[model samples]
Target chain A: DTAVSQTPKYLVTQMGNDKSIKCEQNLGHDTMYWYKQDSKKFLKIMFSYNNKELIINETVPNRFSPKSPDKAHLNLHINSLELGDSAVYFCASSPTQRGNTGELFFGEGSRLTVL
Target chain B: DQQVKQNSPSLSVQEGRISILNCDYTNSMFDYFLWYKKYPAEGPTFLISISSIKDKNEDGRFTVFLNKSAKHLSLHIVPSQPGDSAVYFCAFGNEKLTFGTGTRLTIIP
Candidate 1:
């Protein structure tokens, strides 16, 4: 069983379209996060949720929103997707919020391409 | 601005040699550092980590060295094997982890 899993391993959609990527963790982690890695392979945290509560919201655009129905799941929904949004989106989970004992476990990643 | 920086894009080392990957961070609030190894099309796997309280942590052939005073960290792999070839990313944990751009290491056989 996968500790962290994501849906839509690959997605291709036209610009202005709306899509969503779902993530779930089986590790019983209390905190989950979303990260975006651009074509240049630069990774940045977009958002974070602790026990279904929004914790950290980076400088991400308003078009992107993260929803956590439960501690085990976090989904990202993008509205009016743009070409700049074409990148690999990764979901991660940790037991605590930046605690010394916590280490983030990442999913396989969702590759999103906006044409 | 990027908080964590891996200046080297790639590195090549002969098998059985030592491979050293370096990373620097501008944020002083980051008290925990970790190294991850990622293969193509797969999620990153934890390699090693070191807290600011400690200067070094070792696991098998992998060792992470932290220099808090210099705001720098390095991962050293001794007797590098071909299986060690992968992209290595450095991460600093505060409220969230900030990762470097990643450095691809190739171990030549």
Candidate 2:
């Protein structure tokens, strides 16, 4: 079973368009996170949610928002996508916010391309 | 500022040899560290981890060593196989996880 899964694996959109990526986890984890991997392969945290409560919000632009409907789902929405928004977005989940194991289960990742 | 940094962009190792990947961090608050491996078209999977309290952790062919004083950590793979070729990332975890730029490992037979 896929512990963490994200939909719209590949998205190609034009500038100024809006898009959303959906993510879900079945590992009974309490924390979920959205991460962006740029072209240089640098993974940076965008947002984190614990039990549907927003916890960590990196210095991401307001144009990007993350919503967690439940403990098991976290979705990312991009408003007025720009070329700089093109990158791979990863969804991850952990058993706890401060996981002693320090391990996260990650989804296959959603690749976004803005022209 | 990037708290975690992997200076090596790529490392090529011959089969049956040891592969050493190094990572450094600037945050002293980060008490937990982890290593993850990712293949093309796939998300990273957890490989091994070490806490600040310990200096080394071993799991089969993978071993992670931590140097708290220098804030340096390294992952060692013994007899690296071709299948071990992938991009490896080192991460520090506190309130949130911070990842270093990945280092791509190529194991040549």
Candidate 3:
């Protein structure tokens, strides 16, 4: 079984439109995270949820919001998408909150292109 | 500011040779260091990790070395195989990992 899976592997949309990417983990991890890989290939953390509660929120735009319905699912919705938002979004999960074990399970990334 | 950086964008190694990828970070508070290998269109898979308290950890053909004083981390693959060709990322932190850009390793057959 796949430990983590993401939907909408590739998305092409016009600017100002709204789009959402969904991620689910069957590994029974309690901590999940969202990271954006920019054009420079830098992976930056956007948000993190631990047991359905928001924990880490980096310096990101307000247009982006993350929703965690349960410990297994985390969804990302972007409002008024911009061209600069074109990047690969990765969803990851760790077994513990602090990840003291130093391991993470990631999903097949969702590539979003805003035209 | 980018806390982690991968200076080398790519690296190439021949089959049965050795492959090394390097990473540097500016923060020293990280208690754990990790390496992840990613294939095309696939998410990164955990390869190896070393705690800040230790200098090295090995697993199969993969090994990770952490230099806390220098804030440097490196991944080594011995007898590199074609299957080892992929992008490798170095990350550090306890709660939230800060990842380097990534180093693309190409193992020639």
Q: Choose the strongest candidate by DockQ.
A: 3
Model 2: lDDT of residue B4: 90
DockQ per candidate = 0.69, 0.78, 0.79
- The residue-by-residue lDDT of candidate 2 on B1-109, one tens digit each, is 8889999999999999999999999988877899999999999999999888899999999999999999999999998999999999999987677899989999999
DockQ for model 1 equals: 0.69
**Model 3, DockQ value?**
0.79
Give the Å shift of residue A40 in candidate 2: 1.7
Better of 2 and 3 by lDDT: 2
All candidates in order of TM-score, best leading: 2, 1, 3
Note the residue pairs that clash in candidate 2.
none
Give one digit per residue, the lDDT tens place, for model 3 in A70-113. Answer: 99999999999999999999999999986466688899999999
lDDT by residue (tens digit), candidate 1, B1-109: 8888999999999999999999999988777899999999988887888888899999999999999889999999998999999999999886788899999999999
Per-candidate RMSD vs. true structure?
1.0, 0.9, 1.0
TM-score per prediction, in order, is: 0.97, 0.98, 0.97
Indicate the worst ten consecutive residues by lDDT in candidate 2 chain A. A95-104
DockQ versus reference, model 2: 0.78
TM-score, prediction 2: 0.98
Better of 2 and 3 by DockQ: 3
